[model samples]
Target: MRPALFASLLLILVSAPMTADCPCIPLTHVWVVKTCNDWNCASTELAVANGDPQVIAVPVGMNDSRWLVVRRFTAGAAVDVNDDSFQLKQFDGMDGAVKHYSGMTRDYHPMLMTAPDGQVLVLSTKQPEPRGRAVAH
Candidate 1:
């Protein structure tokens, strides 16, 4: 191969951009998740342009790496909830817990309590599932 061609090829390889990283899940219309080491690393609150916590405590949950309902915080923030980037106030400095919390409609499944364990509690606003066919009285 020509020397110039070989050098050009080398330059192209060197100048290529690295793999685009996975995007962070936005917690509220505010915070987003950050990742490192091929795993969720931390939860960071997005400054309100002027630097202030979004100040909304949407409940967060922790699943056991299986996305199953392990526990749910009815009073936490999704601001870093969809991923493992939330801080557990009661878990004794246990950070880096993945939050699968999703489906929010005017802040009303859960209210005023935390699930037995922290798992992403999908907010269900609809009424309970029907039991059988309806009948007129």
Candidate 2:
């Protein structure tokens, strides 16, 4: 092989792994619950450009409990809610534990709450599964 061609191929092979292993910058957004009802709560939406911590409320009671629901806001958004670069964290209070959610089964709607000790809990309604055709294993 030509010396120049061999050197070029060697350089490409050495740099390929580095580029693949490059870490991605984290994308974060905080939603502050302003009002609550039996079903869902209203939250303040902060722009994606703002990289500040929005005020989050601790669950007061069963009626005032809130869940951090994840979804894609835009069709062409760079990061999806289930992406590793995207992260969701819940805090009980200023000095409470922080819960991180990533790479979980995607549900149409999931009710999630963070305990005072940073445990992530899920709330689900007891409903019978809809009938569907079974697939052969």
Candidate 3:
């Protein structure tokens, strides 16, 4: 094949929007709380309605405990909230009458907690529609 043809094909492949093989349930909201001490605490919330990428900074301190609250979560979905160092555990609604790990089955809200670590928290999801794509001039 000619160089020009090969280059064109490569560009098309590179610029095309990538899609996931299986459908994913979108996350509506996420709340992160960090308790540094008895009185000092910090929290951040991310609303993922538009499927845009979100990020939050974890303050530097000896975090006594950390909690994460997520809404619109589904079982067996490709959802993840983690830093490079550690990943948060996933809980599916509830188990029987007893609530497990602060998870509520009524609204699909699950709470997750982890050890004190990580610098930044990043959240991203693949929306049903294709994201922005590049067009060659």
Which prediction has the highest TM-score against the true structure? Answer: 2
Per-residue alpha-carbon lDDT of candidate 1 for residues 1-103, written as tens digits (9 for 90 to 100):
6999999998888766455455766452222222222122211222222333222233233223311112222234433345543222222112312132223
**Worst window of 10 by summed lDDT in candidate 2:** 94-103
In terms of lDDT, the poorest run of 10 residues in model 3 is: 118-127
Model 3 C-alpha RMSD vs. true structure (Å) is 21.3
lDDT minimum window of 10 residues, candidate 1: 89-98
- The lDDT values for all models are 0.32, 0.39, 0.35
lDDT of 2: 0.39
The local distance difference test score of model 1 is 0.32
Best by lDDT: 2
**Could you give me the TM-score of model 3 versus the true structure?**
0.19
Of the pair 2 and 3, which is ahead by TM-score? 2
Error of 3 at 77 (Å): 5.5
Stretches off by above 4 angstroms in model 1 are 18-52, 57-137
Cα lDDT tens digits, model 3, 57-82, are: 34322224443333333344444444
Q: List the residue pairs that clash in candidate 3.
A: none
